[model samples]
Target: MFENGIVGSLIMIAVGIVVGFFAGFLYRKKIGESKIGSAELEAGRIIERATADSEAKKKELLLEAKEESIRTKNEYEKEFKERRNELQRSEKRLIQKEESLDKKMDSLERKEEQLQRKVDAVEKQKEELAQKIAEQKDILEQLSGLTREQAKDHLLESVKDEIKVETALLIKDMEAKAKLEADKKAIDILSGAIQRCAVDHVTESTVSVVSLPNDEMKGRIIGREGRNIRTLESLTGIDLIIDDTPEAVILSGFDAMRREVARIALEKLIVDGRIHPARIEEMVEKARKEVEVMIREDGEAATFETGVHGLHPELIRLLGKMKFRTSYGQNVLKHSIEVAHLSGLIAGELGADITLAKRAGLLHDIGKSVDHDIEGTHVSIGTALCKKYRESDIIINAVEAHHGDVEPTNIISVIVQVADAISAARPGARRETLESYIKRLHKLEDIADKYKGVEKSFAIQAGRELRVVIIPEEVDDASLTILAREISKNIEEELEYPGQIKVNLIRETRAIEYAK
Candidate 1:
């Protein structure tokens, strides 16, 4: 049993040894797998850490690139803004320069206009001053004894007259020219007067007389105890005398027109059945008005014939009244007509205003109508009438200057004056009294006797000239010139004569030694 037990122990020990070895093998495998799993985990941790570090580096590089692009864009924008600001500044400067240039141009234009106005004002003042100085010089020369040229000559004579022979010769030539000019002027004046006055006059002396049909017509005119006659006289300003003469009644009035009115009124009263005071007055008034109308018509007709119009209405009426008037025993109306014709003829010859001249001549004697009633000269009255009627200045000057009452100022005035003289100087225009004739003769003789060497003097040729006898021993040949000049001056100063007078100073030294 003991032996068996020992063998079992040995077997069991061997089995136990096998089991211990297998278990040892399983522990070694588990320990080795655990170590392998721990190494794999360490490698995964190292890979995850490396991946995280690479992602962080990529994000940083991208952020740096984005920052670089923004910085570059900002630099470009700054450059663009600076260029735009510079361009705007340049545009503003240019605009300011343009405005300044325009303002300067406007100021220059205004200054030029002001300068032109000042120049014009200065020129006008200069003209006015020159005119005033001329007027003052003229007045001073007239008031002083010497003329402007004469005073200048006297001042220059002390320095230049003796040394300047050429000047003396020039003065001599100028004096001769001045004398010739004076002679020519005198001749021209005389020729103009003669040409203007060269005309003929046709005088009409008879008044127009109208005949009635019957003397029995006078009874109707003397209606109801002289009521018609009294009315006619009062209205017509005429006296009616029914006399014993056959078929005749006398109408008398100072005015020739008044008598004609009375005659017509009387005839009308006879023709009408009504012959009372009122009817007579009506007929006379109508006749007077008819005559006045006829007078105006005649004036217009005469003006038409002369080709002169545009006279005032009042002038026409006044011209009509002059038709029936008379002057110097001549029919005033005929004289006016003749004067008008003569004035036109002379105006044509003298180259004057023919129409205006005819008008003046036609109306020159218009004052004769009122000369009997008005207290003034006929010429003065005519001038007033002409001015009041607004006649032209040429015509007004003619009427007053015709009779030498006023000086003539124009060619038309001269023509009218000559025409008036021609009308008045006709063959029977005037009659001279014996007293005036002898007085003129004596005055002519006295003028010749006033000379130094005149022993006897006689007026001949109707006192046109004076013939004087002088002793030749007492008066030399040169004394004849002195005597003639003295007589002519006396005649001009003292004698009032028409045209001109001639003075003849004849001194003869007849030495007759008879050799018989």
Candidate 2:
């Protein structure tokens, strides 16, 4: 029984130990399950947080993109609005320009129609004048005993004689009046300028003649069979005239520049002592280039000297042409310089714009260089050129009115006119033909001789006066009135006297019956 009880106790203990072990294992499994649950919950929280952060970041990114898109859209809308406004403004301006153009066209058309009507009116007036002249002739024929033709001739001749004297006096009076005012002021300005600025006149020649060393040099220049001379003449448009004048050769050409080219080339060839056809041609071409350089340089120098900037290059080149031009036996460039100086002085004295006046005066006669080829007078040509070069209106008007092409509108215009006259009227400036002078005197005398009842006509006072002696038998005191009228009318139609001519009609009668 004891052995049985021991075995049973051991069984119970083993069973109990197994039970405890199972309990402990069960407890451990529960705790581990709880810890696992807690860890799983924590893991879920971490995943949720990471998901929330991702969502937040995505939302932020989406908002930022949306904002950027809005900003870009705003910028595009603003740009589009600005462009629309600009387009609208441009369209409005274009409409306004079109309207202005249309108005201008209408005005021009209206002016043209008015001018046409005026022209027609003027034509009708001219016809009316002709008819009146015919009616007057018929009436005068009926009054006079002579035929219409004869009366017309006699009346014209008599009127011419009377008009000669009265016209002279009238001219003198007008001149005196002009001298008292306009001329006096002009003289004061011009004299003050001229007195202050003293300039020397220079003589210029058209031909550029070169002197050779000797007659022997001519043969070398001519080369064998005159080849050198031919080459030179062909290359340079100047004619090389090898005359009997020892050591003197004349270079003749219409172009002053070409003549200068020939002169300079010939001089170089002479100095080099190598005279041949090839050498002549090469030298001529070289000289041409050199002369062109000189021309451009001269233009640049003149612009620099004058202190007048912003001249067109073409205008400067044209100014260079004046370097070789001459007028009335005076160097044109020198004359221009003198005029500029004088004008400046006048401007100083008169409180006018000196620089502007001097510039205009210097360039006033620039057209004369090319006037030979141009159709208009020098003043007109120059004015047109100034207009072409876009010169000031004042300068253009001054140039035009220098020779009375248009009326003087400014003080500079008057200054230019006076200066031109002064330069032209200077001693040895111009030469007149003897035939013209003699014809003028005869014309002056013949004007008074055609009067009726005039016994004799004498042109006295250096052909200034027409003294007519009328016989008392032929011409009575009352008839002198008609004679004077006839003579005066004729002078107006035929003569172009500057000042005047006096017509004196002397009528005297004497009777001596007892002595006879």
Candidate 3:
């Protein structure tokens, strides 16, 4: 039974094997078919995709080519248009240049023709002039019965005399006319400038009066045995005059700074009621310091008001000293300021350098600040100071020339001189002693009278003007100007006056042909 079962099992196993082998073959074949189908579909899809891609690439290439073609066409058109415009412009320029050349050629031709004609005319005129000269020489020789040279010499002498007389008269007439015009113009300009300035004149005295509360205050200021007054005077360099005239004490000094210090010190002493020498000294010291501070402030104020800057510290201090200084009873500082303003105004009108004019005018009198201590004229001293300060050459020149001590180098110096004269010579600008005033007037009149043609001389306007009546027969219109100029020159050379002197020459011709 085991063998039979083994045989059946073996047979069954072989059959199963055969069936399994067939099933495996069938499954392998099916898988191979499925893989082949998938590969074929994938290959078809890849071919379609490649075809679509090639079509899209062809379209993109065509679009790019079209755009490139359009761009090239546009660039070509733009270049062509630009070239066309450039060619048109060049053609127009060529046309204009050709027209200009033609016009210039015609002008040159016309000028050449005109020159040729002028040359021909000149040749003809030369021949005619030679003939006329020869005929005139023959006629003159026949009429005079002398040689050509002698007759020519005699004619030349007569013509020369006649020319001299005629030229003299002509020159006199022209000179008179010119002088009148120049004098009128000068008067207009100066008067206009003065009128525009319109500055007030201020005159200050060296003496200052300090009012006391009562008469007893004067005695207190004098102190016991006059020790206090002596101390005050010695310290401040001022004289204290306590006169028995009301409740006032007079502080007198040549130096304005000293007088101011003394005045302030006395006022303080009177107020403090301390009438001792020690107290007086203390008050004087304080007053000196106060005055020094005031001087600095005044100097700064002057510079500020004048709009001047960049001055050295020493120069500013010296300018401050001018506050106390007086010239002919006129405040030096005020005069300087007035001069500076007037100079700027005149400079503006005359179109000169305003800054330089103002600076020169303000510092023109700076030498006066130290003139009292220095042994020299103010101009020399001022020049030295300006040189020491390293001022500009023009500034130094202005300082030296303001008083006519030296010739002015530039217009600014002249402007400063004029402004200074205007400031000092204006009405009521300065005061003089009665005797000196009379002497100046007489001197001016005498100077004018010394001239040859002067009939009568009159000094008017407080010696500022000298009017001279001249004989018309002796002094012609031209000689009148010369006489006035000579008189002015003499006054400038001989006399020492504060301001300019105006010399007026009057010439009147009277024709006494009565109505008979």
* Candidate with the greatest lDDT versus the true structure: 3
RMSD of each: 31.5, 30.1, 18.5
Q: Write the per-residue lDDT of candidate 2 for residues 1-516, one digit (tens) a residue.
A: 999999999999999999999999999999999999999999999999999999999999999999999999999999999999999999999999999999999999999999999999999999999999989878877787679778779989999868765666666666568868997899888888766653222112545668888899988888889888888898887788888989988787766777889989999999999888778878888998998788777767776676657777766777777787777666676677667777777878889888888788778887876787899887777877898999998889888877666788999877876766666666432434568767766775576676667777776775567778887998766556557556656776787655577777889998858864
Provide the TM-score for each candidate, comma-separated.
Answer: 0.44, 0.45, 0.45
| Candidate 1, 336-446: lDDT as tens digits | 778888999999998887888889898887788678789898888888888888887888888888877788989888888788778876653253557998998899898
User: Which ranges in model 2 have alpha carbons more than 4 Å from their true place?
Assistant: 1-204, 253-255, 426-516
**Residue 413's lDDT in candidate 2:** 79
State the TM-score for model 1: 0.44
Q: What TM-score quantifies how close candidate 2 is to the native fold?
A: 0.45
Q: Please, what are the lDDT tens digits per residue for candidate 3 over residues 206-237? A: 56889999998777777678887888888888
Segments in model 1 whose C-alpha atoms lie over 4 Å from true places: 1-215, 426-516
